[model samples]
Target: MFKFWYANQQNRVRWANSFSAEYRLECGVRQGGLSSPALFNLYMNNLIDELSRTGIGCHIDGVCINNISYADDMVLLSPSVRALRKLIDVCESYAATHGLKYNATKSELMVFKAGSKTYNTIPPVMLCGRPLNRVTNFKYLGHWVSDDLKDNADIERERRSLAVRCGMLAHRFTRCTTQVKVTLFKAYCQSFYTCSLWVNFTQRAYSGLRTQYNNTFRVLMGMPRFCSASGMFADADVDSFSTIMRKRSASMLRRFRDSPNTILGTLAERWDSPILGRWIRLHAVK
Candidate 1:
């Protein structure tokens, strides 16, 4: 762990007129630095500890998860609406004590199982003395998360976005060679698959993405949209989008297995039987 030393804390900048301005950055980590995330995690350690003591987060098989934090972004979890309110209260108190504040306008409430009768009667939640706006869908970590936990909406949105990006790429790289165009697509558009980690990808969604993938390659290679491109793909030695998704999913599963104590790991263990089903028994030696 990098120690937060006085010497390392010094930050200064020069803006206009050859003049220099210096100020003590007494809070938060440096933006865009390699070690910033680690430093921020260290800074948030105390807050996490405090929240853990509250016993207000989601509890599964005796393990409690009050919240998840990635750098400064946070998602507080609770089993009940009342408990969620308390959790937010604790969060607000912690922030106040730590010289931090919530962006109430940006903060929102999303009730899961929103169609349940219990949710209809639940009171509104407030943060920073203002009611949190209730939303049916919100984007988290660049993926749309809906109240129903369905991926179709998110997948359609991503498809449209990918189409728009491919259109722009086609317009800008009209003179570029096929190889160069493929390279650009790999660099810029591959993340569309990479970022879709938690989506429950339906067959329709997969087909749509695959269609887009094939069309993008076809456009780049100056081939008709209906033309077969198996030879082109073989020549480029690029994996299909489906293959990439499988590889990424397997990699993610391995990571989940490694994270034995995390919520994801716990869920993975709980669902192992259902996930593997009779396949595990079928593959096992007698």
Candidate 2:
């Protein structure tokens, strides 16, 4: 049945209102197909298993946590530079054997260390015959990840997004009715989706975010810039900034506790760890 569905798949391109001749797909699945990610996962399972057998990446209590994968986005984690290079070598070999290739230009290497000029001293990691860029921070899956592993960059990103949304709302929807404005505000503005994962950010950064969140509602409602936001959220029937973060983080903790995967569940067990403990203390359900 699978062969019948996948065999002799043909595709064509449409450009300038003209149709090109269909060509047989010699390899790879259809892009954006529902099963593409699953098929890709199946194809990459052998590489994952090989990496596991090597036992060269980060591990926690006898569990191999060398990699984090989501569809095609994969992040390799290792405690030391040597182990990381080995993991990259293994990935390169597997990609060659499987007819897959890594784009060295898009790839970046970041080392997590405190006050160390590691990038200057360490040799570059090569992929596809090109060296990967060494970066202090990079965006992954919509969140900014830094070598310091702090949440400040992501928070600043969210704050900037909020400011842009606020200006859009004020300019585009100034004459909108209160009900319409409220609806649009909730849809466009209250998007602190990654707040639950914020742990290592400073108080000032969070306060700035709160200021922006309040300003968004104020501008949408045509209220004074310095007006108190104490009653604004209640009047708008929307969640407050603190409430949003608290609720999301609580849900995250619950998921961690109830996750079927033992490694994920271990995150909840380590609630007292420096990272998780700060999150729990600041946002856990009272």
RMSD to true structure for each model, in Å: 4.7, 2.6
How well does candidate 1 match the true structure in TM-score terms? 0.80
Q: Please give the lDDT score for candidate 1.
A: 0.73
| Candidate 2 C-alpha lDDT tens digits along 172-225 | 989989999999988987778688888777989999999989988988898888
User: lDDT: which candidate is best?
Assistant: 2
**Any runs in candidate 2 off by more than 4 Å, and if so which?**
1-4, 12-27, 115-120, 283-286
Residue 4, model 1: lDDT of 46
Q: Could you estimate the TM-score for every candidate?
A: 0.80, 0.89
Per-residue CA lDDT of candidate 1, range 1-286, in tens?
Answer: 2454644666677577564667767766667778777777888888888788898878877779988877777888888778888888888988898789999999988877744433655688889999989887898776787777667767777788888888988889989987788888788667665332434447797678778877887776687878765766777877666556555666666676788557777756765444333223323523
RMSD of 1: 4.7
